[model samples]
Target: YKSIIKTIKDTPLEEFYTSGHRTCQGCESALVMRFLAKAAGQRTIVIGATGCMYVANTTYYSTSWIVPWVHTQLGGSGAAALGTAAALRALMRKGKIKQEPINVIAFCGDLGCADMGLSGVSNAMTYDYNLLIVLYDNESSANTDIQETSMTPYGAQTSFSRPGKQRRIMKKRWKKSVVPMIIAGHRNIRYAATMTPAYPLDSINKIKKALAIGGPTFIHSLDPCPKGWDYDPRFSHELGVLAAETGLWPLYEYTDGEIAYNEPTKSIVEGRMKRKPVKEYLEKQGRFSHFTEEDIEHIQRMVDEMYEEWEIPGVMPIKSL
Candidate 1:
């Protein structure tokens, strides 16, 4: 454990965004934010949106940023990031901030990306702004106590989409696939989907690739919210692994229209790769404990269908899992 800590420390301070701050207990976004900053390096600037991350990590008196950071409105982080990228370019030309190039990074929640900042994020991609946008997808509007968002999984009960005899469904709508939607709008940038704690190495590699690509990039990150998910804080990393293993969140990257899916673990034959059932991932959360076997089966089917549709290579069918 000490060796692991030493390696993490040696990775370089410029790679993470947050250095010192107090985030809420069971909050998973903090981990991803730090990793992103570290990947973007010291010369980067981050444009944050109003969400759990913005409020919990950054307050009036103190902050966790080691780089230039800007907090934008709930629906305008992407646009703000674009403007910052433009300004930085202009500044570099005039030798203002420096003559060297820098990375412009953006961070926001699913609500900000899929709902409020959808247009702004889309436009940023369309304009081909040299920015890296990281959407912290926690499935629920966790800041508001696990409210349903368009990205929330089906058959999962939320205050907005309660499951009962009258309601009968968890979330009536399909998840808004923001990565594909962004691709449809802008063909110039790379896109990827990743999960925290589960695929840290892949996540790190993706961020590095995004920075080196020299164009706009979008990374949809699945960061488990323990408070909302009703799991022990210690289970955050395990939950992330379960999510990928269940095919609920596949570890994949889309670069310039091409898609690459990361295997859930090192190998399938070893049995180490087979993730626990979705029930293990969902059952710990009060939100999903209410689901019956039939409901569970329905959710399982959806997960399987998604894997097939995505044509995720090396992923055994859900039935096998």
Candidate 2:
């Protein structure tokens, strides 16, 4: 692990997604795209869905992407990427193109992934397309004025979940676990993992691994949105770390029917590191500012239940026993 980290750190800086993009300050999705592009290298084709990424990176005629990129519909990027991969395979088989292997990557936001594009993504996984699907989950429909997405946490205020004087009704639904949904639906998926930019090394490693695996790879990255979540822009990384440490977003990898909990998650499972309070995570963002003491306790219970559902004996347990 040290060697791998050293190599990644020592690697010469190469930017596939260059500067001059129109992303806001402390944009986690932008950071995730940059990291993924760096790991994927230049011999890659990116299919971006209609969301913050598409609007920010490709304004009118100008684009920040240096490699081949295509814009797909909000709910069509997954299928589009699969089609691109199939075309490439056909071309290679016909000896029409003699260049090195090119990777097809689909980039989508939480709205596109869990809500609008769920069927497309599930179908792509079912077909076992040789491509990478990256879901940059910011937990809300950020580009659409911070509307509540399917991945939005409960007790969070959004455009769709406005607080009322009579009864403040935040999001009532819990964030959907797309990872388990994919795993349960597609048995042939070569690789899947949850990552965050807070751990750059881990994120890079997972991207590299997914690219190497070559068949229906999925990576769910927690993207902290300062605008949507209403947090200090500079605290993006801090928020990510807090989310992981508090078990609000536990990092783990699933491959070949085996799951491996990573870092603080593993430590928490083994009783080496105590799971931090979920309130520490929720209180930091304005989205959850409306959460009461009872709401906090309910969220804490939900997190505990989530951990238990994802537990794997000797790898990740229900609690620090």
Candidate 3:
């Protein structure tokens, strides 16, 4: 049994996801891949679905992954994960290889995981397979020229949802509820959580725990995209931090059939720390550049209702957890 990582000093210097990719500058999703790979260590097999990480990182002669990696269809991450784990188990039993536990992880973006891949992931949750599915949601179809996805945040401008004089606001739909769907529908799921790359330690620890627990697990990560979110590349990490601090995104995990909110978010809920204004979070991004005071207030009210009225913040709206 390995010891739990409590500090940055505790993390090792060796990196498993080395520098070979052609990702955008200040890409938080790239960091998501980096940290998850670091947490999973070298004894891991990664499945990359059709998305930014796969399209931008891999080529015929070159690759970024140090561990074994494979690419699957857009919505096939979960099914591929189940097949991989089952095959590993079968191989050991058949004496083709030594018996040991190996970490199996799959990563997909919002366009793949939330839109096309949703059904495959939902169905895969029922099986008792040892694997982790990470939804690295940048809120749009970024790799395919930034088209809108179901998980795109409200009032944001995308290629498909571009704003014009005829319509000032393009995207009207709220960010789709993802982790909650996993928690509610999959009764036997061992671990489910929401995190952002802004908090590296918290994100890494969550990945570690999800892998430690047996059975299929899911983690939804809100990665800040400089291009998609229309922010300066330098503020990618800060934008992620502001997202959680403003209560627009709440950090929490579901395990052992109970819900627990992480730090700062927990502090905000308990009145120890005040959640920053939504305007502060919005004004930093170019996507919300067209937002008026009324629009900002509208979003604030939605965020307020989520943290104040909902039973599990953004998960369920019941009276109690």
RMSD of each: 4.7, 2.7, 1.4
- Cα lDDT tens digits, model 1, 25-110, are 65668888877876667778888998888887777877888788889988898899889988888887887765776889899898
Stretches of candidate 1 off by over 4 Å are: 1-10, 13-20, 163-170, 265-276, 309-321
Model 2 lDDT on a 0 to 1 scale: 0.86
lDDT of 2 by residue, 209-261 (tens): 88888798999999999999999999999999998899888888898888888
Comparing 2 with 3 on lDDT, the higher-scoring candidate is 3
Sort the predicted structures by TM-score, highest score first. Answer: 3, 2, 1
Stretches of candidate 2 off by over 4 Å are 1-8, 308-321
Clashing pairs in 3: none
Report the Cα lDDT for residue 117, model 3: 89
Per-model CA lDDT versus the true structure: 0.73, 0.86, 0.89
- Prediction 1 TM-score vs. true: 0.86
* TM-score: the better of candidates 1 and 3: 3
Highest lDDT among the candidates is held by which one?
Answer: 3
